[model samples]
Target: MKIGDLSLPEILKKTTATQGLCFDVGAFSIRLRSTHKNFIHTFHKLYRDFPVITDDQLIDFHIDMVIANNYRRWIKPQIIARIDGQQPFQAFAATHAMPLFEWALNWSIARLGQHYLMLHAAVLERHGKALILPALPGSGKSTLSAALAQRGWRFLSDEFCLVQPIHGQIVPIPRPTPLKNESIAVIRNFDARVFIGPLFEKTRKGTLGHLRAPTASVDCLKQTAAPAWIVFPQYQNQAEVLLEPLSKSAAFLKLASNSFNYTLLGATSFNLVKTIITNCDCYNLSYSNLDDVIAQLDVLSDNAQ
Candidate 1:
């Protein structure tokens, strides 16, 4: 069953503050327990396509978002996120519960999912091949990925590029892409069909909103794609679209720096990164226009095929 199959009351009933609501997101299963009404409503809408897992299934992470039991609960109203019975972050305003959930999930994946070579990147698939956009924040990674996913590519993840070590394949972990500040408007204007959540103002990352993962991408959660291209994307205002070829050696160093657990994995991570760099076409892409970049990527994919 899917989250959408249940009504608000039904979801509330199944996801009691005690047992939590279990759902499958790609390879990971999460049990989320929250009593925040707005958070539940928004989560239900954004994660409607994800598979609802039974409590009998093995859960990878147990997350709870509850109202603070202090004087602040009534004064300012704060929400605390607890993962595996441990509070990893300070309390956030009750209004920022959704962002807290998203960030907490990211933290859990990065810290616990050491099986894969996790990179700070946005991954998308086309014709069974993955295109990785690995860049630092404000480099237009999420925006570009979100745009590409809307165009034709299947979205894997906007935050993590999980590469299996042995097979050298990219794992799909499709989730809502968080759009910060101006990106919220950029995506909204870029695609009329895109569904963006409510604007969350004055957070640490500035005003934030999330783009719902495409239904097509969410449906293919189990599908994995081999790495074919790595493009380091940067959004520059009024800049002409440019895609410059990058050396494999340079790609290796950059990708290594972008990894979450590169040092921890050691030699295994080294070999996997080498394999990816050797096999994939590497490029440095800079653009101001989304349509132009999308067109260029389409041409690149077609020519490669």
Candidate 2:
């Protein structure tokens, strides 16, 4: 059954009691438990489409969100996230519990997902090919990715680019796209059909909001896309779409810098990254208009055939 199949009270009861909610989230199977009402509500809304399993299955990340039980509990309650019985982050206000848990889960994956060559980027696929968008903060990577996903490209992931080094294929890790600050509004206005999670105000990264992955994209989680384009995107106000080709060596260095486990993967990582750039077109894209950028990318991908 899907997570949305259960009512809110049913989810709360299951998590607070002995039976936990076990679900498949792309490459990982996560078992989550929480008693806080707000956290429960957000979890239900964010992952409504994910499949829930009742079997005694092995889970990669076992997480619990609990209210702090101290003097501060009376003053201002906070929620703590414990993964595998270890707390990795500082306690956050109870109001921020949902985003905190999501943040914690991403952290757990980056630290524990050692099998793949993980890059901190946004990725999407179309026509059996993947578009890897690796950029620094404020580059509008997430915003552009959300736009592309809404415009028909299959959403892979907005956070991590999971690449199978041996095969040079991009694995789908379709999760909610965390839209921050103004970008949240940008996406909301861009796509009326997109489902966005509750607004998280004053987060460390500023006000945060999450866009649920498209149902079709999540349903095809097992499908892998071949690396076809490595494009670094930047958003400049009032700037027209500017696409410039990058040399293979330059693309390699930028990709390596954005990778989470590139150095850890050693020669395997280096070779895989090289093969991707060699087989795909690499470019730097800057634009202000979303439609223009999307059109440009469509033409670029078509030319690669």
Best by lDDT: 1
Q: How does each model score on TM-score?
A: 0.99, 0.97
Poorly placed runs, candidate 2 (over 4 Å): none
Q: For candidate 2, write residues 130-225 as lDDT tens digits.
A: 999999999999999999998889999998998887687888888899999999889989888888988989898999998999888888888889
Candidate 1: where is the Cα deviation over 4 Å?
none
Cα lDDT listed for each candidate: 0.93, 0.90
Per-residue lDDT, model 1, residue 30, is 99
For candidate 1, report its TM-score.
Answer: 0.99
Best by TM-score: 1
Per-candidate alpha-carbon RMSD to the true structure: 0.8, 1.2
